[model samples]
Target: LSYVDGFDITRHWGNKSSYHSANDFDMTRHWGHLSPYHPADSFGIQDIGIPSNCEVSQVHILHRHGQRFPTTAFNDGGNTQRFAYKESARWWASGFFDNSDGGSSSTSYDLLVIPEDGTENNTLVAHDSCRNSDDDIIRCFEDTTQGVFTNNYLKTVLARLSNYLDPKFNLTIMDVYAMQTICPYEVAYQGSSDFCRLFTEQEWIDFDYALSLRFYGNRSFGNPTGRVHDIGYVQELLARLQNQYIYVGNISVNSTLDNNPTTFPLGQPFYLDMTHDNIMVGVLSALGLNYFKGSPTGLPYNITHAPNPPENF
Candidate 1:
């Protein structure tokens, strides 16, 4: 985390986190779920367009819901929901479809119908996405981060703030991270916040990596229940692609909905389903997209390197 040198005046920025394994990127566009919609081109696929000889057929499009407030206070509903109804099609949202976009649509149906990427897990998840128990991966990640993984960064940050912070306030390392996270939210709420310039660019990158590390263990493939979250969606996709009524009991997949032809149509031009960002990660894991699983720069969640950041980083 370097300084802005206090010389440049045009929106000079110092940061302690970056969004993704991006290049000389200036803005923080890699803040994981909180980040703006960026391409998943990290896969390094050469040809993205459809082949000249092959025409577009059925397309299964899965994406996260629009920008919403943090799930802490309110549900993640946003103004972007209305736009989904701009097209003429039957609308179906997942189970946790609490946010209603005026219940308006271009289709004959008065309200959005059917189940989609909403919180539609009506059944009980065996693992239930990892509880906050001490044995959970989250606890493991937290323990590692606060210990050998990043003791140096935390200690250094704590040391750096010893003189400036008021003696009345005792801020711990977690509090320091909370301070770092506030910058993005503050910028989003208003136009800006001085908090954005608190840290240098390298610090921003380190924080982002820390976050990625946490997500890797708790939300993504590192957790036992990670891929299972999207297993239902993958089964539905396969049913549509194969044009069959394949029914299998799953942790989250609704059998009644899948069996009904009216609800689960096999043939369609394109299907759009909205889901949580974590579920999409599960989908990637379910599909075995190894491209997102690693990188030459020692990314893809090789946590073995975390304890030795100086050597690998």
Candidate 2:
């Protein structure tokens, strides 16, 4: 009878050109038969089970970050520069010469002189040259580092949760705790690149320096070793919870008319954890509740099936 709801805040930030409100995104109107809330005569538990009596013991909200400026090849350009550099290096090693460098016919140089009108034309050549020769990619790195999507969206959502809790619950103010992934720099910078490759000595040093700059703004460093610390944080919290103690005392009084009049007391406490989408999906999938057709809420008034409970629970 516990009142539990699963929500993905990022899902609410759907394509801006489309629906505007939560009601508008209710699937029934968007995709016809594919909608979870179709027929208009059906009802889901979320709609009909209002005014539930169960007090919320805990809430675990796992959601994705807000809309991101598309990071795939469709948006922030591709790995064309990296691939081109590899190709150029291979061609040069195989005796391809750039005649631009003056030298004896027998004296060979390893450089690919891309033509002005080819695929590697003026624009692409200039971009590659800047990214390779002068580390102009730093500007791209900085642009993403200072971007606003994640931080702003997270703050807004947290504020909304705080406001909702203040009026809806009677628990002590300090009972609620919120936590998020700590090493966002790693998440943001790694992009789609594979990080398993062994780095050269200079490459390793450069990576360390870049990581320092990312975490500490090139001044003071904090936990530059990546996301391993989050595991320790989680373990520490769990240990504290396991070690917590509670006590209760009984009082007795005598009544003149009634011989057996007594009361029993009970005590309970709970914990809540805030996390992200992948963790939720992983858990749901493990519990065999990850399957879905259209929307999460099923059909409209009485049409589609309801969301299934997690099998493990």
Candidate 3:
């Protein structure tokens, strides 16, 4: 049987006045670049070509976490630096600064946009620890990735700050990626962040240029687009995923699914796991998601064919 398209489903079941298909949220454009993890307008059916007599009795699902910044801290990767008041003033005086912020020199400054000090020590610390023992299910898997402040998340923090911050002073974001990701939301939401207040209507037009560079410029280390190309990590996760349902003894066992569902109905009613995009891509690869796999000319180990953020499946 052919799968029902999302648009068709929406037309049939969604409110007629405001129905929107998942296609409306295309994940290939500027905002769509935040795909895979981006919210879907509605869930659609996938064509499996099952026999007419067959019926689906059980469903399994795996999903990535919500919007977040690159795992490697900006400072660690040299992608961002702490805001320096003296340096900014000097740059502006020497004409070395770009007026991405709309405010002119004649405009009196009330609020200052600066970065927190001691950013050098912003290292990737262990979020949790896991032992090697096979008996402990809770301690078997743990996420080691670290996340920095970027993307739509910035808007969330900035919105909160606007309530207490003064409107007189202009704000500037030193982190390019953070600014790029936050730019869209700032334009839509008036009370976004103090940093957003710096951009005038005219400057907002040219702001896309800066964001493009931050997104498409550097290719090494997954710059512009934060992606993981390490094959070792991908392979590791794929191995674990493939073995996730294979039940073995307590020593070195990896299966999570109960072999006998009739005997253990409540054993695995619902399974939820949260992970980073890098690992999620690996799982997708193991599951044989062809579309996610990059072109033959491009290497998967280089993130040419990997799952990006906000992908819903």
Models, CA RMSD each: 8.2, 31.9, 20.7
**Candidate 2 lDDT tens digits, 154-204:** 333345446756566653311211121111112233321122111222222
Error of 2 at 307 (Å): 19
Q: What is the lDDT of residue 213 in candidate 3?
A: 24
| lDDT of every model, 2 decimals | 0.51, 0.26, 0.31
lDDT of 1 by residue, 1-313 (tens): 0112221233333443322223444545434455444454443558668877999888777655332234422323232443332222233432223324524433322232443333554222212332332365545743454344344455567667766978887878766676666765544444355665666556665666666655555444555555555676788788889887657646666677677777676777667665555566667777876554544332343342333332111
Q: Where's the lowest-lDDT run of ten residues in candidate 3? A: 121-130
lDDT of 1 at 248: 62
Top TM-score hit? 1
Candidate 3 lDDT (Cα, 0 to 1) = 0.31
TM-score for each prediction? 0.67, 0.20, 0.32
Cα lDDT tens digits for candidate 3, 1-313: 0111222223321333111234452111233223223345544667667779996543433334332223336432333322222333433433322454434532432222222232211101101111221123321121001012232223443454455668864443334335544533332233223333333322332233222222222211212122222232233233444533234322112223223333213323332333333334434443455553334432222121112342222
